[model samples]
Each structure stands twice: as C-alpha cells, then as structure tokens.
Target: MERILMSLQYNGAAYQGFQIQHDLKTVQRELERITQRMHQQFVRIHPASRTDKGVHALEQFIHFDSHLTLPEDKWMHAFNSALPNDIVVTRVNKVDDQFHCRYDTIGKMYRYRVYTNPLRDPLKVNLMTHMPYDLNITDMQKAARLFEGTHDFTSFCSAKTEIDRKVRTIYLSKVIETTYGFDFVIVGDGFLYNMVRIIVNFLTDIAQGFREVDDVHKVIEARDRTKAHKTAPSEGLYLERTFYSEDELKHCVAELNTL
Candidate 1:
C-alpha cells in the first residue's frame, strides 16, 4: 500500500461536517465513497482537522493508505473528477508510511471574516458574518494581541467539549481591516472546540463596548466558560493553513502577506 497526503479546499455550507455521520453528507464520507469506488474496496481517510458545520476551509490536509498505483500527479484530477463541486483536492503527494496528517501538524492558522458594513451584502451571506453595528476596530485589534501567548483557554472553548486539557499556545493573533470588514487571523499550536469562535466573539464584544479591553486576561485567568462571550457564527471562519514546522509557518505568513 502507498501512503499519500492531499490538500483540499471546500465550501462547508451544505455538509454536516468533515466527519462521517449516518444518513448525512460529510467531506470525509464523500471522499471515502469516491475513493472506494476508484479502488473497488473500502477506503478510510484521516483528516488533519475536523471543521464544524458551515465552516469553510481554504486549505485542509488529509492522508490515506491506498493500494491503487495511480501516479501522484494524477491523483488530484482523479479525485476532483468524482468529488462534489464544493470539495476539491488541490494537491497530492506520496509519502512514507510513517507520515500522519494530524499528528505531524505543528500548528494551524484560522481566519475569521467579519462584515462591518451597515448593510448586508447578499453575495457574501454564505461566506462572511454580517455585523451591522458600529465597532471600535482599534480596540478589537488591541484585544487580539493579548491572545498572543500561551494560556489556558478554558473560557474560550465550548462547554460540551470533553477534553481534559484546555491549555494552548498562541503563536500569532491579529485583526486586519479590509474594505468592507475585518479579517482576524490566529495561528496556534492547538485549539479546543469552538475556541476561535469564542475568541472572536469576545473581541467583537470588546469592540462594541459590551466588554472591557482587559477582559481577555481576566477570562483566561478565570478559566470559566461563562466569563467569555458567546461563540461566533461558523460561516465566517476558515481554516487558512496548517504548518508542520516553525519555519514553514513563517514562510506561509510571508507568502500570504504578498497576496
């Protein structure tokens, strides 16, 4: 069997989530179905990240073992031919058996798009979260910087999450203003369920004068879920990139800034 890693991009509006569920559409389910059809046998895929419903991905990673002997260059086109229009395989690479998509990931970068316009744009309804109220972008940007270090993000994750540890290190966090909205980028060693969404909500609340600028520090120290703001909508969130090393992450940031 040959092990392969593939990068994918998908619009998450229609699917339940990335994982498989009975009688529901999902990215992994569709991928496996197509792969099984091609291989004429059951196939399993390992995804690097499990994105929530309505959460899109600019670049997602996965690895799978397959007996099919197709050339690496043809895998992307072959997979895209059978996959749904919303999901597409961008790149494929053959790797040693020891390589794992999830375990080998060193960090991940997520971006949240917020529309700050007074009127909602119909074109962007599925992709961007509409926030029609006035906001202090400066304060929000400042608050984002406060999250740029290691902290126990217990207050910023969903209470339903069963994970024992809530500690994660933030490598980078910044909010940049765009023509119609703001883009919040966060790079972290790891994340808890709904962590990014909750952090965005907290920053927005601070910008809207509903919370103090220093509340981020207080909530991190409190480790109380109730101390944080509500989780933001999933549609605005996108898995921008994943990094396998610190150097790769720095290179990605440099490349992204030029775009």
Candidate 2:
C-alpha cells in the first residue's frame, strides 16, 4: 500500500461542502467515489480543511492510502477525468503513510472578497459579496489590523462552534484593495467555525461607519459572540493556502505583503 497526497482547487457553489455526505454531493464524496471505483475498494480521503458550503478553495490538500499502484501523474489524470468539473486536482505526490493532511497543517490563509459596485457583476456573484455603495476602506484597513496577533476570538466565531479553545494566533491580517472591491487576507495558526466570515462582517460594519475602529478592541475584550457582527455569506470566503512548515508560512506572509 502507498499513501498519496493531492493538492486541489474547487468551486464550492456546486456542492454542500468538502466533507462527505452519503446522501448529498460533496468534494470528498465525489473524489472518494471515483477513487473507490479505480481501486475496486473503499478509499477514505482525509482533507486538510472542511470548508463550508459556498466557501471556495484556491488550494486544499488531501491524503489517502491505496493499495493500487499507479504513478502520481496518472493518478491525478484518472481522478480529474472522473471527478466533477468544479473540482480539479492540481498536483499529486507519494507521501509517508503517517502523513495526514489535517494533522500536518501548521497554518492556513483565508481571503474574503467584497464587491462595491452598485451594478452586480454576474461573473462575481458566486465569487464575492456585492454592496451597492462605496465603503470607507481606510477604516476597514484599520479594523483588519486589529485582528492580528494572539487573541481569544470568542466574539468572532460562531456560537455553534464546539471547540473549547477560542484562543488563536493571527500572524498576518490585512485588507488588500482589488479592482472590484477589497479582499480581507488573514493568516492564522487555527480558526474556529465561521471565524473568517464573522471578522469580515465586523470589518464591513466598520467600513460602513456602523461601528468605530476602536470597537474591535472592545469586541475582543468582551469575549461574547453576540458582540460581533453577523456572519458574512460563505460565498465570499476562500481557503487560499495551507502551510506545513513555519518557513513556508513566513514566506507566504512576506509574499502576500509584497503583492
């Protein structure tokens, strides 16, 4: 038997989410179904992140152990041919049997897109959140900065989150201007449920003058989920990248700042 690692990208609009749901379509279900057909046996795929419905991924990783012997390139080709058009395997490699995608990840980067044009762009409807009016981006940028560093993000996560430890370390946080609107880029050691989307809503509230930039400090201190803004729509969130090493994460932060 050999363990294989795969890097992939998917548009989450078509599926319920990344995890397998026997009754509904999902990224994992689609991948595993095709894999099982190829191997003539059950193959369980473990993913690095379980992205929510309508939350896209530019880069995601998964691993599985299969007894069928095939070259990495051929494995990718076979899967891509059988998988749905929305999901594409970007790369594949042999990995140690012990390497699990979820457990091996050291950091992850998430980006949320906001569109400011009054006229909705049909192309961007699935990619971003459209707001009719302009926003105070300068204030939004300030609010984004406040999310950096270590903090107990109790107020910024979903109330449904079962995780006990809300404390997490944010290494990088910034609002980058885009042609359509702006993107909230955040890199962190780990995240609780709906963390990124909630933060985006908080920043959006600040940009709209509904809240002050200093309110972020207040919200963080409150440690109450009700103190945060409503969770932004999942359509605008993307899992940008996942890192396995400290150096790779540091390099990505430096590279993102330059761009």
Candidate 3:
C-alpha cells in the first residue's frame, strides 16, 4: 500500500462541515463516497482540519493509504471527475508512509471577511458577514496587534470546548481594508473551537466602539469567556492555508506565501 496526500478546495455553504455525520451532507462524506466508487473499497481519508459548518477552505489537505496503482499526474483528474461541483482536488502526490496530515501540520492561516452595508448583498450573502454600522479601522487594527504572540485564549474560544489547555501561539495578526470592507488574516500554531470567530467578533466590537481597545488585554488576563464578544458568523471564516515543515511541503509553501 502507498500513502497519498492531496490538496482540496470546497465551498462549505451547502455542507454540514468537513467531518462526516449520519444523515447529513459533509465534505468528507462526499469525498469518501466518490473515492469508494473509484477504488471499489472502503477508503478512510484523514483531513488536516475539521472546519465548522459554513466555513470554507482554500487549500485543505488530506491523506489516505491505498493499494490502487493510479499514476500521480492522473489523480487530480480522476478525483475531480467524480467529485461534486462544490469540491475539487487541486493537487496530489505520493508520500512516505510516515506522513500524517493532521499531526504533521505546523500552523494554519484563516481569513475573516466583513462588509459594511445598509442592506445585505445577495451575491455575497454566503461569502461575507455584513456590518450595518461604521467601523473604526484604526482601533480594530490596534486590537488585532494585541493578539500576536503566545497567550492563553480561553476567553476567545467557545465555552463548549472541553480542552483543558487553551494556550496557543499567534504568528501573524493583521487587518487589511478591501474595496467593499476588510479582511482579518490570522496565522497561528493551532486553534481551539470557535477561537478565530470569537476573536473576530471581539475585534468588531472594538471597531464599533462597543468595546475599548484595552479590553482585549483585560479579557485575556481574566481568561473569562463571558467577557468576550459573541462569536462571529461562520460563513465569513475561511481556512486560507495549512503549513508544514520545509521538508514536508517544499513546493506548496511558495504558492501559499503569496496569498
């Protein structure tokens, strides 16, 4: 058997999430079904991240062990032919048996999009979050800087999370103004449930003058979930990219760096 790794992109608006569930549609369920049809056997795929419902992914990674002898160049064409319109396999490669998608990740980058408008745009309804009020971009930028470096993000994660250790390192955090609105790009070593959403909401609160800039430090110091803003809508969150060491993903890093 040989282990193969593939990069995928999907529109999450129509699916439950990345993971499979009984009687529900999901990215994993669709991929697995198509893979089984092609290989004529049960193939279990392990994804790099288990994104929440309504969250999209630009370059999600997955790996599986298979005995099929399909050539590397034809894997993308074969998988894309069987996948639904919403999901596509962008790249594929054979790897050593020791490579594992989830465990081998070094970091990930996520982008949250928000637009300021009086009425929601039908075209962007499932693509971005709408903010009716004007935002203070300067204050929001200040708040984003505070999230950099290592810190315990207990206050910025979903209360439903059962993980005891909430510490994570933020490698990059910045907000960029776009034509219609702004994009919040964050790179982190790892994340907890709803962590990125909560952070975005907190930054929005600060931008709208609902929360003071110093409140970010106060909330982190307090480590209380109740003190944080409500979680942002999942539709605006996108898993931009996942990072691996130079040895693991040498060619992919250059492409991702330009994003």
Best candidate, lDDT-wise? 2
lDDT of 1 by residue, 12-93 (tens): 9998889998979999998999889888998899999999999999889999998889998789888989898999898999
Stretches of model 1 off by over 4 angstroms after superposition:
253-259
Please report, as a residue range, the 10-residue window in candidate 2 with the lowest summed lDDT. 125-134
Q: lDDT score, residue 42, model 3?
A: 84
Candidate 1: pairs in clash: none
TM-score per model over all chains: 0.96, 0.97, 0.93
Considering TM-score, where higher is better, how would the candidates rank from best to worst? 2, 1, 3
The whole-model lDDT of each prediction reads: 0.91, 0.91, 0.88
Position 127, candidate 3: lDDT: 90
lDDT for each residue of candidate 3 in 1-259, tens digit (9 for 90 to 100): 9898999999899999999999799999998887798789989999999999999999899999888888987888988988889898988999999999999998888999998888889999889998878899999988998998899999998889998999999877888788888999888889999999999999999998999999989999989888884899999999988988644343443443454
Model 3: runs farther than 4 Å from truth?
A: 246-259
Error of 1 at 69 (Å): 1.0
Model 1 poorest ten-residue lDDT run: 250-259
Q: How accurate is candidate 1 locally (lDDT)?
A: 0.91
Write candidate 2's Cα lDDT for 1-259 as tens digits: 9999999999999889998876888898998888789888888999999999899999899999988899999999999999888899999999998888999899999999888887989998788888777689999988898999999999999989998999999998999999988989999999999999999988888988999999999999999999994999999999999999899999999988886
